[model samples]
Target chain A: MTRFRRPSAPSRLPLPPLAAQAAGFALTRLLRRIARRKPAILSRLGPHGGARFLIDLRDSPLLLLMEPGARRITAHPRRAVPRHDAAIRGRLPAFLAMLHGVEDGDALFFSGELEIAGDTSAVLALRNALDDAELDLTEELAAIPGRPFDGWLRRASGFAARQSGLALSRQEAMR
Target chain B: MMELVCPAGTPAALRAAVDAGAHAVYCGFADETNARNFPGLNFSRPELAEGIAYAAARGVRVLVAINTFPRAGDQAIWHRAVADAHAAGAHAVILADLGLIAHAAEAHPGLRLHLSVQAAAANPDAINLYAEAFGIRRVVLPRVLTVDEIAATNREIEVETEVFVFGGLCVMAEGRCSLSSWATGLSPNMNGVCSPASHVAYAEVGGHNEARLGGLLIHRTPKGAPVPYPTLCKGCFTAPATPSGPAQTGHLFEDPVSLDATELIPKLQKAGVTALKIEGRQRSRAYVAQVVRAFRAAVEAADAGAPMPAGLLAKLTEGQAATTGAYAKTWR
Candidate 1:
């Protein structure tokens, strides 16, 4: 199939400004959880052992800087080299969904929901690295709560989605 | 009764299809033998056996698709796939290559064979040849036939016929197209993947987002707008115009709309189609379940002479666009 030109859709409801704080809170939990869980999932993503990345979550003022393959992950890291190895741009919920394996990156790219700019190979390596881990977002998120996390996650994500009018930013909170 | 055959990319999707009322669930091993050679998809040998048993318990059958063509030097892989599917108790095996079909028919004479759509058996002669030589019991007809042509061919061929009722559509004649290989050096025939992800690149230029397949521009969409997977035939390109001022640049062949013949189910059944196929093995379990449930209702309504559900699968279609492709005589 080809040429699925989307009729001009009203832009997805932008993440509410107030929700950005909550998104940051959720994102920190997700990153820390993933770091602890997969440990080295992004270790091989950097090329030449110095690939730096900037993740831009649309509709939010937050910017994340990462040095892939390095043990330490710095949020909004300072870059002596003006250019990052790559920049991945998308809404926070989309990235969380992609990280959780609930959403397809190919589909998101096709639908113009996600964008990658800069070193294509680095992005590809990152995708492969994360995919190889086969991390379960649901199960990992459950590590936050004691039991019955699935139901709690669903309800939280739903509540977050309703308040923020965001896709899955709230559920990603538990991450 | 017309059979509603569905696809399952994962074991979960397979179970979902069976639970949603598929007459037969078609899947493949997680390798190059299947058309959808996506990573993190498909079943292992043990998983296939489990899937078959699950379907059997529900009185639903499972068909194994090993439809990609065998490489000249290594036909053993394809042969092994057929033997394994048989050993796993698949109700039938869907095949495409001539030699492979011959080998299966000769080695296991009792096994039921269905000619894959990749064979592109469009006419009566090809169908008859496959039936007589390989003992193929069914042929998945290509998407190029009109309803009238299908009825006419059914009158001439002895084997049962199946047509795609929902899911993706290919404008080119199946099994014979080289557009993908021309650009990407991989095709459904040899690599079992068309428009592989490795070669796909999406870039933003100016204000529009462009999708490229093997570095060739497939289509460009407005910033923040939806773009389709860069399948070569479905891309937007400029074609030289006849004595016109400027070349035409647009979806030159077919738009990125999926095939949805739910409205035409009764007509296709009347045309003597023995089975209806849904053409996505790389979809999610939710997608598989929804499409199967809707199509099951449609097929049942057609069989019982009841009014079919209207717009039952509109949201599930590609970009919310669907068509009754090549089914009407007017299309030809």
Candidate 2:
């Protein structure tokens, strides 16, 4: 009953080349920070550590390539999406909902809102690792080790989430 | 009123299930001790102990599932799981292997036992045998029984009976299927996974999403369509043409649909079922909470003598379709 609603309009977030590069850099930095704090997220991947995953946003032209073994993520245009072990295609809200534990990933996949291809096991391993780690992106990004910009990051994430109607942090009340 | 027995793959899921109104939650150690032995899933011993405490504090019981059959030479591994489960103050240990059950009964006489569905004790004789011999307090009936059959079996048995009301559907007889092993060389009964993700692959072939299990084509969906996880029993295949007929193509064994018996909660309660189990230990905590909440509402409505909630969890089913599976005797 608490399923995330599919956006009524076919609106896509616009990311120019420079914006995409900056977003990718921010994402990669955040992932590396998370990996350093929670090693189990990568360690639990076991043999699938080397698998590269593609986060294909169906409504957007941007794609995210995640290499857990290297603890890095890079953004690419849809046409330039590099070779990867697996790919998951969904809308931004769906991905954010799953990442924030606001919705079930399996339910989203089962409902036909998400599409996965290539190596299923690698994708599954990544999913399990993330689930086990229970990462809250907003919280992780905000804890910037001795940096005063932590507050600004939290504020920006909250503002972005509010403006876009996306869930970027764990909803404790829902849980 | 029937107890709501939910699944929790992690401590967080355990808390979610409890908060969502589960009467009990079942889990297993992060090894081959249970059927859902997937990577990055299940609990360590300390985590299990902590989860038990968390559930116990909330008045929700935690049942340890050591349901996988023991290997010939590695009985000790399964034995340690049972012992550790009891030591962690588990309400009961859900067991499948007869030898392992017997071992638990002998070694820890104080520990309560429940016959896992993997035992395939669909008949009253088998149920009674397990109850009398091993002092099993409950029996998780397999998915092969109809409501009338379950009622009849309950009439002939003395122990409590539990049934799966939701989640993945296993068309094969529980604990006896070898399709996964035939394809992957790894068995659910021995290694604790069926159609394991490690051996599964998905490919974009000719604008179709082709799902393969152990290198064998199982299902294919047109691009952008909902793709099912390539579980062997529910896979699509082409049966070679024979002299008698043309080749058959489709879900040869069973369709990739999940079991959603929520509407039958009243009937199952009338059938003398002691508990209703939701089967998704490999799922996320959000999923666990969502399902637990819905089932709790349905069970409450049933207990209050009210109509069951309509489509309480329609969106969460696999393939967005649900089946009563054998419980209604649909074939008949």
lDDT of 1 by residue, A1-175 (tens): 1122233322334445555446546656766777776644544343423666677766444466665445334443122223577778877666755554445454555455678876555665565455435455555665687567767886776676567534353222433
Model 1: DockQ score: 0.17
DockQ values for all predictions? 0.17, 0.58
Q: Where is the poorest 10-residue window by lDDT in model 1 chain A?
A: A1-10
Question: How well is each residue in B247-267 modelled by candidate 1, as lDDT tens digits?
Answer: 788776777878998888898
Model 1's C-alpha root-mean-square deviation from the true structure amounts to 6.3
Q: Name the regions of candidate 2 deviating beyond 4 angstroms.
A: A1-21, A59-61, A77-80, A145-163, A173-175, B240-247
Candidate 1, position B320, lDDT = 55
Lowest summed lDDT window (length 10), candidate 2 chain A? A2-11
TM-score of each: 0.78, 0.92
> Model 2 chain B: which ten-residue window has the lowest total lDDT?
B310-319
Cα distance off (Å), candidate 2, residue B237:
2.8
Residue-by-residue lDDT tens digits, candidate 2, B134-234: 89999999999999999999999999999999999987889999999999998888889999987888778998888889899988888767778888889
| Total colliding residue pairs, candidate 1 | 1
